[model samples]
Target: MFPPKLATATLFPLTLGLIAHFTIAQATLFIDSEHLPQAKQYDYIVVGAGPGGSVVASRLSQDPNINVLLLEAGPSDEGLLDIQVPYLAFDLEPNTVYDWNYTTTSQPGLGGRNILYPRGRVLGGSTSINLMVWTRSSRDDFDRYAMVSGDDGWSWNAIEPYYRKIEHVVPPVDHHNTTDEIDIGIHGTRGPVNITTANAPYPIDPHVNATSQELGNQYPYNRDMNSGNPLGIGWTQGTYGNGVRSSASSSYIHPFTSRPNLDVLVNATVTRVLRTGHDVETGLPIFSGVEVAQSKTSSVFAINAIKEVILSAGAINTPQLLLLSGIGSSSPLAALGINQTVDLPAVGQRLVDHLVVANQFAMAAPEDDLFEAIRRNETLFNELLVEWERNKQGVMTNGPANHIGWLRVPEDEQGWKEGEDPSSGPTSPHYEFLFAPGFASTVAGTPVPPTGYFMTIFTVLVSPSSSGSVTLASSSPFDPPIIDPAFLNTTFDTQVMRAAIRSAARFVSAHAWDGFVTGQAASFADVNLNSDEQVDAWVRSQASTIWHPTGTASMGRCEDKDSVVDPDLRVRGTKGLRVVDASVLPFIPAAHPQAVVYAFAERAADLIKLGRHLC
Candidate 1:
């Protein structure tokens, strides 16, 4: 097993360094109670300092007159070291007080396994804990969002500018410049967030390259995957600057925290939204302020909002916060002895996340193995850290899994038939492949190596047909909520996942890999090959999520009773209230959520600013 603290020490310093450099972005925020004016009102109050919250805060505060308040339950990320390196995220662990440390209630299909889920508890939230890959979905994904929200502006064309507005791409240097082989028109240059491809000393496994090329050659219209159309396999673009993570706090919020109008409260846990009087006669209620309790303190205080309340608290927290504030299923709240303020039945419904079926195989040789270096000598490990800290170049700066692909399983295959998008454009697929250079010996820890040096080809099922729910585990705000992801609950989801695993393995076995693979010292040949049942079993044993959870407070058309937010992201039936986060996505985005969340927040900030002008 890998040393536990090895990952933590390597990643922590970079995390803190980024935070100290970026806390100024939240300068407009009022962190102390003494700063609040009598019955004070602000132009906007954004909760949760994650991707959406930070972006909204950064963008809305651009106007010198507008006052923005950003509240986060976690303490400032300052001085936290492990979060800085891109590759050491796994070492931070569920034990770190900065993690929410959520666990699934029970995934019925995975034999009731309760997997550990970690959400960032620091100022930047999960973005600080993420892999930092800047991946975008196919254009159709946004078009579908526009269709669901009844808004024409959500299409790919409508939001591309926002994506470009938040990114600053570091050009490829040296032999790593595959700019000739891939498309670059889709990337941005002068944005708040810095993004770039790295040329870490790690060599691309010849087998991996040949296998991916073989698949592309077999498929038609196999364009570069990072292009607007993500059909073929390619290297992943990452969100990093000088080899360190570029979280929203580090990129967008950090630069502007010195403003006097902004106020940020860390370690404040909001119990519920305070209501003045229940419009009992009309069954409608008005929210006045939010009740917050400082972590490890009994002093609960209420902070009132003057103008509008925004919930950018992420998919899980946004909905849960709503329900705790008596804005959820009436019956459930009543049972918990809480009076219902707003009967929004869908508050905690529609939990969606990506599911993956990973296939692991033994490498033919261990010469280039990551484990060989780290395990063999402490100096090699220290050198890796120095390389990242001083030069911002090395394995620590790049993700162990640096390649990604989008694939369409044969429609005739079992589960692939059920979740087919009738509206899909050419080259889009319901399946994705995330290739990594290591395997896991246990689910509770970092990537493993004793399986004799292996690679994991994880197939993710996006747009899963199955739906799940998030509910109160108990009446208390401190109690963790019940999360039922319902993985593999649908026959179609399982079928497509199985096929994806087979395809990934088949590519490795093909003659195209004969020259690259060589079969010399391959470790996993003992396993059964060319059998669907065997592939299915192995998939279940190794699969893991890419950690993209969305749709808890999904947006929808005005008439849809289940909708939590309007297309503009306002919480229905409440004034001066809105939710600008991943929870607003009606469906999961086709790619990583960090980029899209940034785009959405940019648009939300514009809407908030325009609305303020009208007032």
Candidate 2:
């Protein structure tokens, strides 16, 4: 066993540096089973090395006495150059090695079209492929979950400290660090993950900023959204370190790669969670181990988790893995030729995600052409590349989707919060607008014919009312599960999005975008500006998802029979099994869930440690 000090988070960076520059292989354990010589057991086995799994494994292994085994189905994030650059996330998706690139079943609500769902198949999971924005959902989101789960301490105030605990905010340099522009009491200064705001130079689009201000002015309750209120136009803050993508791997996993007890097995596809008993009358199945097949060798192996089997395989994969292990709906298990051990009817229910639209507006630039920058800027490209290589700063470091705004549905809008509920009245939030500053377009087929230059506003409907589900594709572990978000299926969801879009269009007409719009930028020239039907029609055709899938295995009170996990994050009917990922959320947060998941996992770790201490 290694010393506890060597496993500390502060030492992680140095250990990772040693692995990257000086070491060949970090360390290896010998496992010589009769059928599978490579099969091994660990004190804690975390499936999927995404944000949640990475933190859990990294922190748990720090105890020195505990050995952590992290298994990822994707290839190693060794030399993915685009992964290092934030703007290049778009280009990296089509590459098979880096992204899972799964598509959902044809949505009945989305004109019967299958939406392309890109998930990071690399070490950091979606964080590697995702736009590196790091906004947390409003505090009400957590309180709502807590209320549903009947867990008192699960509220935002109870968990907000964890966000600060894991966060290490890197002060902005020059104009980029808008700390003065936004509030900081709610943010953190010292932590593991680095959070920074984008300051890449773009002419201050008056219309965009002015319109955003107007919306806030008109909706005074939402002014200063970034001040833990999240209700107006603002610059986007994200997990970018001097512009390079700071994914969970770069910030969490990679930093601990050299730890003696933390073992990571990449490209290992887990087949099933090994369980012993089937009859609940007798008892819940004892989670013995995980059966996995090596991607390179196609050889099956069984690895045991001596203490716990935590599923951080994400919303889709986590439920599917559980079902394969005989822990899901009875009907589906029987249909797929799998025996049902635990009839958890809600293993893959209550799915929710943010539906977004790439609102494209054409603009004549003052100097540099937009298409020219994406297609032909050799000098600019090379200069930015060299700058990043030398100093880790530039446009290359910023995500294509930078700058965000948060807003609430109008009082007249569907699902609008009617005068503070008599039972559950006034509430505070972190932020609501998920704004970005790149031209948003479809990625399903060959890219749309490019307009010369445009600044697209991707307004994410974060607090969506529509919910969907995931089901087995013939119970096969290898088969991709069927996911249908049923976007815009509800009148409440549709109306809320319509209000958001109209509000955004108003902002475009505002002064903030005046200097930015040199030419005609409106796409809907035919639609009458004042007509509600025209705006609603435009919204229906244009809206798409922001790709933040969650809530397949929600945490809830005992009364919620469909809930897969308890508020403590333990599998409802099973012992020694817990889920510590986005799937546990009862509802989608009003902001991005990256920071929320980190905070949730931290609280989970503390709870587990507390339970152990009592023992």
Best by TM-score: 1
Give me candidate 1's TM-score against the actual structure: 0.89
Q: Write the per-residue lDDT of candidate 2 for residues 1-615, one digit (tens) a residue.
A: 000010122324433654474334423321222332244448888888788887888888888778888888886665456677666666666436777767888876666777877777778888887777777656566677778888767887787788778877675533444644445676777777877776475443334455545655653423224334555566667787655677777777777777778888777778888884444674766785889876535678777887788999998889888889888888878888999877899898988888876555556662433324544445666566567656777666666544566665544544545542211113432123443333445434434334456556565667666789888887656678888888878766666666666665666665555656543244544555467777666666666667688999898886667789887788876767889999998877776777778888888877776663111
Q: Provide the clashing-pair count of each candidate structure.
A: 27, 24
State in Å the error of residue 612, model 2. Answer: 7.0
Error of 1 at 187 (Å): 2.0
Q: Which regions of candidate 2 are displaced past 4 Å?
A: 1-40, 173-177, 204-207, 212-215, 219-227, 277-282, 366-372, 413-438, 446-451, 518-523, 526-533, 612-615
On residues 1-615, what C-alpha lDDT tens digit does candidate 1 reach at each position? 112345233444656666776575344544555565555456767789999999888787788888877888887765455677776765655678778888887676776677776677778888887777776677888888888888767778898888778878775433365564345577677887877665464433445556655665633323345455777666667787666778888776667778656667777787777775444554545575787877545678877666677888887888888988888899988888877777789898888887765555565556545645465556777788788777766777775466676777664654444435532555457677666664433245544444465555667887576778888876778888887777777766777777776667676676655533433123234446466666556545545555777888988877777899888887777665788988898888767788878888888888877773211
TM-score of each: 0.89, 0.87
lDDT of 2: 0.67
